[model samples]
Target: MTFPLLLIPGLNCTERAFVPLLGSLWPLASVTLVNHRRGDSMAAIAGAILAEAPPRFALLGFSMGGYIAFEMLRQAPERVERLCCLATMARPDTAEQAENRRRMIALAEQGRFDQVIGANFPNTVHPDNVDSLELRDLHASMARETGAETYVAQQRAILARPDSRPDLAGIRVPTSVVVGEADMVTGVDGAREIAGGVPGAELTVIAGAGHMVPLEQPDAVGEALAKWLRR
Candidate 1:
């Protein structure tokens, strides 16, 4: 039987975050997009997904979703058949990063999410995509759907996640790390860290892409996933 596949979205992201890749890959596996809006901690978010997931499954997570994926692995390694992380990190939030999340939460509480979105979108896409209407609209719609409360919840969750680097050295499952070469948020360095620690894991960097690598280069991401599945 084909293993179940769980797709986890980033901060303030919904199922639409996987829409681009889903069209091409859904037929190959049972794909479920796990929601991250309800939980205020990584453990809680991972627990929610674990509660709803099948007995054994493959996990594909992007950005903040990747953090939850790591937590899931920590929670139950045997249940994860395969693992993939896109534009994510294994380290806990630095003091500065934690401060930034706190500030974002404060802004959300003050009803300044529009400002938050404006500031965040530029960092989300590559420079070439900064003016792309499709990218802008997609991100705008995602942010709108997520709303301030969800964003705050995700930020808090991310800030509270433990450093996962130590855990990576022990992950025995097939693993892959995908990243955008131009990703500024969680750059190639983060991807390298993950791939380096996970024995025999592959790392793929898509050109001309940024933090939103899955959305920016869906075909490549899909191909990578398909290859991993076939292995």
Candidate 2:
């Protein structure tokens, strides 16, 4: 019995985030993209996903979605058949990062969302992709779909999430940690830290990619996911 697979997107993202990878593995498994825009906290978001998810499922999460995935593991470890976190960190936000989030929230409230998107783009993609018109346009379109209010809510939720490092040792399910070599936002070191905490977890690094590794290297990501599911 193959488990259902759920994909969770990062900040200001939607199902479109997985579009690049969908064609690569659609027939192998049932894939569902959870809406991360509904809730304002990790707990709320996790709870909502859990409530809608099948009794047991494999989960792949990116960035802010990774934070929510960790909360889901904490909430119900048994229901998860496998877990994968990409371009994410297990540590909670530092004071400075939290303050930055607050500032972004304020800016969003003032309807200056394009400012937030502009400021975030550098961290969201590889430095090379910063000038890539296609990547930039895709990101901008996704951000627009998410809206300013959703962005503010997600930022707050991420800022408030607990440190997930301690919870990792308890993870018995098969796990994978993937990161982009050029990911400045959540660097390879962060993915390494997560893999280290979870015994026997696999780690994959995609060269020439950034925080949005799945979008940039979907075929690589799809192959990694498919192999993990088979194991």
Candidate 3:
């Protein structure tokens, strides 16, 4: 059986972030890439996405999108048929993490957005792929396209997002937590935390990948998502 799939991209990431997985997913599902740049708060962003989303659909959220996903589940648990959290965590940002985001926002505001994007590009992929011009350029392109304003807003939203740990146990839908074994941003421990909280949630750790697992190891990440969608 086939169903609608709603995808929420990460901070400063456009639909381009999921392009690699689309080939494997297109035939198995009706996919929609959500627009999450319009709102400054998690609630506002989730509400806007829900207002335009299908009545019910499989939901996949990556990075900051996971925060919005939690908010959506809180607002309308009945609307999500299944959930996939990719390279994300259920906890709110730590003080250090929040500080880093503030620094990035400041850099963006100072018209050094390119530097901010460049610095983050290497962290998105595994060390082996850090020198890959293709991945680096793609990351930069996506960030530039997303623009500084949206980037700042997303950083702020993520910083202010509520801790989703308590709500995980209440999630009734089928759930999958996918993360890169080498993820520097959220790390495997974070993924484990989410999987442990959600009843019967499956955990997929993709080796040789990092924060941007979908792009770093497209085939592996695609297979993981396809399996979850089939389940």
Among the numbered candidates, top lDDT falls to: 3
Candidate 1 Cα lDDT to native: 0.87
Return the top candidate by TM-score.
3
Candidate 2, residue 132: Cα displacement in angstroms equals 0.8
- TM-score of each candidate structure, all chains considered together: 0.97, 0.96, 0.98
lDDT, candidate 2, equals 0.86
Q: Which stretches of candidate 2 lie over 4 Å from their true place?
A: none
Instruction: Give residue 152's lDDT in candidate 2 (0 to 100).
Output: 84
TM-score of 1: 0.97
Off by over 4 Å in 3: none
What shift in Å separates residue 194 of candidate 2 from its native position after superposition?
0.5
Q: Give the alpha carbon lDDT tens digit for every residue of 109-206 in model 2.
A: 99999998888877877777788878788888899999998888888888878999999899988999998889877678889999999988999998
Candidate lDDT scores, in order, read 0.87, 0.86, 0.92
lDDT of 1 by residue, 47-159 (tens): 98899899999998899989999999999999999999989999887788788778888988999998888778888888999998888888988988989888887887777
Error at 158, model 3, angstroms: 0.8
lDDT of model 2 at position 106: 96
